[model samples]
Target: MSIPVNTTAQIWVPARRAADVTARGARLLRMADGCAVFAVGSGTHHFLTRGRPRG
Candidate 1:
């Protein structure tokens, strides 16, 4: 799927597909050891960090 320039707050996918998401332009937020977090756009920051869809 194509991620638009302005991404939404929720993007649910299996953990194994994280790399694919990143390849589609989602911003990698944090990385340590072998784990990473990604944000599709500015509006997703909270969702990425909190592990819950923003209300």
Candidate 2:
């Protein structure tokens, strides 16, 4: 899946394929330890964080 470049917020990509961010409406971010995590939901409605395997 591809995200449009016109998106307002920043888009993140996972280092591994443990979770399908596109299927869950989520995005991946890099941590200080170089690990990857998925961020789901927007604003304060609902949010989740999950660890992903390293690439």
Model 2: per-residue Cα lDDT at residue 38? 51
Candidate 1: Cα lDDT at 29:
61
lDDT on C-alpha atoms for all candidate structures: 0.42, 0.42
lDDT value, candidate 2, whole model: 0.42
The superposed Cα distance between candidate 2 and the true structure at residue 15, in angstroms, equals: 8.3
Model 2 misplaced stretches (Cα beyond 4 Å): 1-23, 31-35, 42-55
Give the Å error, residue 8, model 2: 17
Q: Which residue pairs in candidate 2 have backbone atoms (N, alpha carbon, C) closer than 3 angstroms, thus clashing?
A: none
In angstroms, give how far residue 13 of model 1 lies from its true place.
Answer: 9.1
CA shift of 19, model 2, Å: 8.0
Q: How many backbone clashes does candidate 1 have?
A: 0
- Tens-digit lDDT string for candidate 1 (1-55): 3445654433454333334333345556654333455556533232222242222
- Estimate candidate 2's RMSD in Å: 8.3
